[model samples]
Target: MTQRLPFLDRLAVPAIAAPMLRVSGIELVSAACRAGVVGAFPTANAESLEAFAGWMARLNDEAAAAREAGTAHAPWCPNLIMRRDPARVRAEVELIVRHRAELVITSVGSPAAVIPALHDGGCLVLADVASVHHAERAIEAGADGLVLLTAGAGGHTGWANPFAFVRAVRAFFDGPLVLAGGLPDGVALRAATVLGCDLGSMGTRFIATEQSLASAPYKKMLAASSLDDVMTTRAFTGLPANFLRPSVVNAGLDPGGTRRDGVGAGGAPALRRRFRGRRDPALGRPVERRALGRRGGRAGHGRAGGARAARGIPRVCIGLGFSLKGASETPDGLRGPRPEARRGVSLAPDFLQ
Candidate 1:
């Protein structure tokens, strides 16, 4: 049942850059491709189809440049969130097909809008799934591959353990498998391989890379932050996402005060003029923290402008091979934990794409 994906086997690293909302831009995508891995971005980042079209053009041009420069350019992919937004989905899928994307990652539903078009265009389709049932449904809907998002992943993740999840999915489909969420480095990538995944899915790791659009602060935060620094909650977006512990502390809420109760965007803080400005219980104030977000007209922290604003880095590129700074200088050959543990008790917001 091994389904072969053409062009995917050419990667130097057995991993794919996760389609980060603000981090994955043309430069980052092209860089990832040149670095020998699949690069991806989400359609939600583009306000309109016209902008998406322009984005596609830029990405393709940059990728071509990388190809001519003798770099290992891999295929680029766009993530499509198929909800009730049929018209939007249709338009983005058209652009993806028209631009000759090598892969298309669809979430929240089947690959109905773009799967056939991608197939007709000879593109590979990988559906994101938080559960085994979703995986089966995607396969039945004719997906070429599956991204098994386990718990502790940055975004929407399933409750299944990574090892068990991968083993379960392997029992059914032998197609290209990518394990997403919390895959920070080469060590995690190797773990994914041992778990029977063809490609490891990395998102947060790229956020700290020199080629990334993540802000300097975000990159620095990620590099110095340990596995314990991340928290999963659906406070910002209507979905679950991983965020920095400092962010929650800045919001003036006790990270461990609230229990993980009730689903569907209920735990989110109510809209306020200013969020609490410090995680330290002692240093607290209702400070007018310049909030970052698209909905409220406030740019999300580190975003440059508009949705595209979310792509810029907030700090200088501080490459930490491992989660700890100065812990390991070697980026390529490190093997660490499958699940990086955090000792602190805190909660964080989740980014939805």
Candidate 2:
């Protein structure tokens, strides 16, 4: 990649499977690595600290096996939410350092508290940001890189255009950059590179992959969905993010794109106490999204336990212009109005190759 980061050299495709909540797990993460891209999952996805340890052990084992077999694969990174209970966060820090994680992506909060320890353990820290200010803060906090969670990203997204956002950050920071949004194909990945990102961070695209932890019905619904079928609202977490419109409708919530249940000040506690009483036909239960990269059962976004909708998305926002033009299967997926779709994408050039 343009950044000369050694790990980038090992990836066949300059991309990372986002560490989504509930959506990312061992299967999805492992598959992404096998596909020549970084695979990641949120540590908070596990119900408990012990369960988190087991998940990490299994992932490390698989990665080690791949290495021993001389198979080409990328690294498995874990996303950590730093604003949780202090003791719990500290425990997670110990586990991460003990595992000797190669890359740790910190989200929703500052990386400052955990950076020194992670660095001490030889783990490079990449902070997730939705704004230029956050990017600056992350850099000042000694993050090794940045993941720009731009607009159109599902599960709490920023509104800045990817092109503008990357340019804004590149003005001061020249370290590694991973752009995350509505990227769904190689062309979008290439487009991200052209905009100065070293890697494209894709979450929605991996949801439908064969190894995704998403339910079959959810995957099928996503594959059948288009840009319009996706809805953007601040009601879920008080941060604008995209969600499947039909899913919202299925929850008996208004699909008119207005804020009805956003977490107001001190709203998290009350929301967190609410339970997921509604069962979804597509998702089986209420969906648990990466709300502000929150930990534990959260609100409105539908965790089975408590309705703890997180409120820490320091904002940003892509879903458009794509053509799955092998002409093999019906071309129905995330598409924008860009004219580049007709020609199709080729292998990435010098920077990515």
Residue 244 error for model 1, in Å? 1.7
lDDT of 2 at 298: 20
| Model 2 accuracy (lDDT, Cα) | 0.62
lDDT tens string, model 2, 254-284? 3442333223233333332342343333334
lDDT of 1 by residue, 28-90 (tens): 877887778888887766657887888778878877886787666788788887653587678
Ten contiguous residues with the weakest lDDT in model 1: 299-308
What Cα-based lDDT does every candidate model obtain?
Answer: 0.59, 0.62
Best by lDDT: 2
User: What are the models' TM-scores?
Assistant: 0.71, 0.73
